[model samples]
Target: MTSSGIARPAGGAARAVTRTLSDDPLGGTVRRTVLPSGLRVLTEAIPAMRSVSFGIWVAVGSRDETGPQAGAAHFLEHLLFKGTNKRGALEISSEIEAVGGETNAFTTKEYTCYYARVLDEDLPLAIDVMCDLVADSVLAAPDVETERGVILEEIAMHDDEPGDEVHDLFARAVYGDHPLGRLISGTEETVTPMTRRQIQSFYRRRYTAPQIVIAAAGNLDHAAVVKLVRQALRGTPLDTDPAAPAPHRSATPAVRTRPAATVVEPKETEQAHVILGCPGIDRLDERRFALGVLNNVLGGGMSSRLFQEIREQRGLAYSVYSYASQYADSGLFAVYAGCAPGKVDEVLDLTRAELARVAATGITEAELARGKGMSKGSFVLGLEDTGSRMSRLAKGELLYGNLMPVDELLARVDAVTLDDVNALAADLLGRPMSLAVVGPFDESAFAAR
Candidate 1:
């Protein structure tokens, strides 16, 4: 019932609340506790920093939606910003921005997060505003209509951006026709017909105590955070587990086809946008580190193979590279390029060959070492920011049940071997490729090429 206690969660699902209580010497210790109502509080104190960032993470997103409620999770995210009984949308914005702080929310396939960042003394205020947004949004009709238009425009913007469009297309090509294939923002047609009642129903079901994670980092006390979470979450009851949907069945791999050198809409833009992708491993896969290293050597940065081959060696494109994106259940490893329209085929062939070469030849010791070094350096650099640390902890709590200390993750990254990268390249990038392209060309040219 209090901040420090040991109680077994019914059905053994409550172990996430049980963590060693110790002072985190690098900054502040991470502490976990469960409220009587079942909410989980995760707090990390970084006294060296002057600002605090805390987030309320709900373990639900697009993957949870059924056919009719395809975009309801994202819809609820917008409605939460509309207003609460005590504050309107404008008031909420003014209040947060007034403090020289920032507030925002995002919806993904597996989670919806609302967070705020402010000076240390303003932690309470940030917490209060986030609590209001998450648990008390009014979802008024006027605001609903207004936000619908805003979301529609957001969708249009993404559709018009070739790079963004290619990523979406890649997801479809990789995941098949499952819910994962659709964009997180949903289509305009889907958003247009959504109603307030639908948003409320989805919100009430998914935003429950047991499923929520409250994480804070910066100058703060763990006990104070536990108190705020307990008070704010007092009467919310947990929803019974929803029936698990049938597994998303992917269609048989499509034949490898050259991406159509075409633009969906001809634009008077100076540069042509392009994206290439391959099916990737899931988040929990052991090969994640290898894939990350592969991405680093292939297209992660200036030193990556894709950059060297596509830009530095050939001077064919201004930008070109590869990276990996993983979700709760699956992933996509992709390469992207922006070049002159005339250079489309040349760039595509170069990218494809680079991918194929890595798969066949495997990475050398120097290449693997640099990839690991880059991955390690980026991970360490990310921790230098309080906000990034806070996010890392919050997401880790949601995904791994406990935070893997920075050292533990880096050690794993360091342990990756050349053999690992080779197998990863073969399993993921080397196989039959699925193509997605957008530019001033036609599908036939890609198929024929």
Candidate 2:
């Protein structure tokens, strides 16, 4: 689809093919090009703005690790910034900061992203610095040792926060020994004993061209961005052969039956954080739109059922919400509440009752309309910034292998009817739940109740 002087080309080996994915009057034109190196570069051009968000997405994460390799993906994320072949860590940070920009990276269950935001004029610098970090990190022994302590401290920091710790505990309770259950930052037990050799091996094996996508948005030209990327990635041994890109490695851990179980972590805290959830659909499930609407109506906002019932009407908790976490093949649907330690049982009962109510009777037409509107507004308002748009493009390519325009995505959300929500709720929320609680109590405290 050609618009605004950008021509679309058919896919080929010798030449990069450009295609427009979307032409939203509010979000600007989205485009993508597959370079000969097997690296996919996606961009959303918004000439109305002056800043750009650029990101390098790698299709590997904690789930890709072996038992002994736990936390290696996260470790490599830190090391990449320590020093590349051309610049040291301080230079990498100062160069971006000098231009009043931000640079950072994060690791998720299924992917890792290194990203930067800079003035549009500084786009080339951003691209060069990020590509260098991805393709030419030294991963020196001394730097590895230093970052190891930093990662361990991060793990410690996470443990000290009970509210955040409970989510990881909840994942463990839900998925058991599966890699999906492990923490992205890993534990002190895992990080403290890791070796540099293990980390370097992970970087070499997982950070390949075929598994990488470079996404950028905001005031930029698609051709210019592609040229900058091509230059930045030159001399790297990226596979450019005629064969199709390498298939992503799968972490197909066996699925286990959902059991009604609870894991209590005794911490000396005034408030308890608990998560109650059941199995959910995978990332590519068609019912995800219905599930999204259901989540919003159930507890996504302050106006949601859980918030209105537990917070506004009963005053049982301070923070309460429901969420869905989707992976490549599996997912979790959960509700979290932070309340007084003494009120744990009351909160759980209320949450369970609400879930049962939704499953049995479904939602009203008013709730369905509100859910769709909220989901649509959130999706559109979120993309007003370049970072969110860049993230959208990257995820669309890495996860789904196509870019879904804003209008098309909204259409899917709008298509969900009350019947769709009821069917999904009945199927997902009716399953047995696994509970996790972090508070000043033991397992017997819950069992006695």
Candidate 3:
């Protein structure tokens, strides 16, 4: 993929500039446009597709919140859909459903996304509703109170799922008081007393046009989608004084502060959920592709080492996997297993032994090839839908500031030599690890084990 000219408005007035970021060897094309207000719009046009996935990706998330503002980003997500100046909650859903489309939003550690998937012909409606909800939400008081109850219940639901809660506990065990380690949904303590004014302030301060990217993928024209977005946001708060788009998030050295080495939440569950890991590389690390390959070899799938030994061989655990979470400036890599409370020690031991073996001797050539193949195939197969494509456009602009083509990405994975994977494994997996466990045991349960 290569690009040509970027036509900025002649006078740099209250207008927009357009650029062709890339053109696939095939007929596919990806484009980027910067609005006068600094809001960005990126799109990939796939003419053969019959549906469109359009989204508004805000660069603010739970990590942007203060202690008192924990979950404020997520709170605003629910409130935005509750009602906007131009549409009520019922109208918002009914309008999308009327066209056989679906809409939803999710908040993460560093960003939030509100999206709609609809028939190609319904792009205009989808664009308008999304823009309105994102930029013109009234954030009424009554809606805040109502959504507060909803979010509290959501938090409760998350707590009941130990499998999911274990991951959050692992994060805390590694990062401690860092914002990145906090729960995205905040706890009942933070959410209960959080005031509407606090959330509203965060909304206005961080939800600026400069920090947002609007992306869409479908059988559509770039210019028309840009026009629709500009029109929808014409008089809203987002279309204010002209400014340049915000640069991608900056990275800083994340300090771990020697967080608790072991965190166990005593519960009465039949199965014990645990994660053993250490801090890993950042998203921009040059070794990321190698790490992906190494992850697959370690515990990425059913054929992975951990899964085969833990589940298929000894039947010590019903589920086992390893995953890496990368953020702008920091990351964590961990192995997780859910097993009978009695077998927790055995599972942990096997996981540690496997991790140590990989770190010491590295993966074989055969294992390396399989790992690379798995990594490449998963990356390509994941983009077989409009939603994933749309997400690629948004994330490219919001996180990396440039789009890497599918072929280039695959090539990166293939370029992972055995040396690369082994070096990363030695450096990453050789580090001291922390452990988090949630099960029917006292805090001292894992103290000895």
Candidate 4:
């Protein structure tokens, strides 16, 4: 409740409040408005852009699901578009498409977003359709069963993709049975048995006004956007008693992880998928910038140490990279390689050597500079579109509870020193790591390797 986000009463009626959060010469002006219903609307008005991306972001994801409600969040996302009191499923899609626009939704480990990208002139239409689907969904029984079959098939298709499945295996290896380790799409056991009533209850209980944010970017007026959102949500579940937006997810009690263990899934695949990693810092960690620099040097790109040594020099693997995934209180840093079955050990050895070398002696000054450039260039380039800009606004509020200026973000990266990267490497890369492999090997095959 006491955070950098919009301050409001924890209970009772909250008055509508608006403020200009930022004014950039090139990025347009960013503004925020918190409605009496506790629904927060944020916008970045880039008049030169002919497209506007509107989204309704909920602060709920697979991480918030109970065991019985494993995939409930994602399932609910699909059913919302099935129908609402005001429009049917076809109407929802047809209306948006009719205007040369596109609308879609996705669920993540920490949040869910339902969004539409339309011509600037059709901003009002985008707001209404997006608002209607989120606020007034009628989760019919028939629709639940239909989507059930679709999701099961999706799960099956995912299983066939060993490349993707390896990441899930690594998550399980790290978090054990924690919700963070579970798949965003609940498995068949959970989805097949899920009932309409159960999902409906989950929806009403979780999607509260205080837990939602509406974000838009592109050519539009912030005030007009807020008004359209209010009108669209006039008589719905979200238009209830007002309260302060819920604080960012609590990070007090850190998420516990499993001991270092190697898990091998023996499947007869052409190439083996492998990930070697250990627990990393959380999103709030002060050393996150250092970690970013280290990750880039380690395996973030083609010129990265791992890529240069493994793929370019020996040609043992076609794909090799390292990444870090951060959550509210816990995170992961891992290296992935897809190689021929016979080359798995060599690949692992090379990867391990690179990690140990970096851990023992930090990267050179040249590597650090290149890493910084890559980090900064990628970030600035990613925001070239309205959707990315809109996402930045929602994530700032839902995840961090404050919009950090672009300059500040760049400065943070710029401030990372050689010692900072080296210190983080010595600490993080030196930690015990777990191994996950999806390949033609027995369970005992990887215990020693």
| Winner by lDDT | 4
| Model 2 residue 94 CA deviation in Å | 1.0
Residue-wise C-alpha lDDT for candidate 3, range 1-449, written one tens digit per residue: 22212335567556677789878763369998887788989899999999999999999988888888889999999999988888999999999999999999999999999999999999999999999999999899999999999999999999999999999999988888888889999999999998888888888999999999999998989999999998999989898887888888877655453544999998899999999999998888889999999999999999999999999999999899999999988889999999999999999999999999999999999999999999988887888889999999899888877888888888898888999998999999899899999999877877775
Query: Could you give me the TM-score of model 2 versus the true structure?
Result: 0.94
| Per-model lDDT | 0.75, 0.88, 0.90, 0.92
- Which residue pairs of candidate 1 clash? 24-29, 261-441, 262-439, 262-441, 263-439, 299-322
| lDDT tens readout by residue for model 2, 1-449 | 22212223465325566788788876888888876556788899999999999999999999889878889999999999999879999999999999999999999988999999999999999999999999989999999999998999998899899999999999889887788889998778788888988888888888887788899999999999999998887876454442233444432553563467789999999999999998898888899999999999999999999999999999989999999998878888999999999898899999999999999999999999999999999999998899999999899888876677788899999999899999999999999888899999999987843
lDDT of 2 at 68: 80
lDDT of 2 at 397: 82
Ranking by lDDT: 4, 3, 2, 1
**How many Å off is the CA of 139 in candidate 3?**
0.9
- Tens digits of per-residue lDDT, candidate 4, 42-130, equal 99999999999999999999999988889999999999999999999999999999999999999999999999999999999989999
Candidate 1, lDDT over the whole model: 0.75
Better of 1 and 4 by TM-score: 4
Query: What TM-score, computed on C-alpha atoms, does each candidate reach?
Result: 0.88, 0.94, 0.97, 0.97
Model 3's TM-score against the true structure: 0.97
Instruction: Name the weakest run of 10 consecutive residues (lDDT summed) in model 1.
Output: 242-251
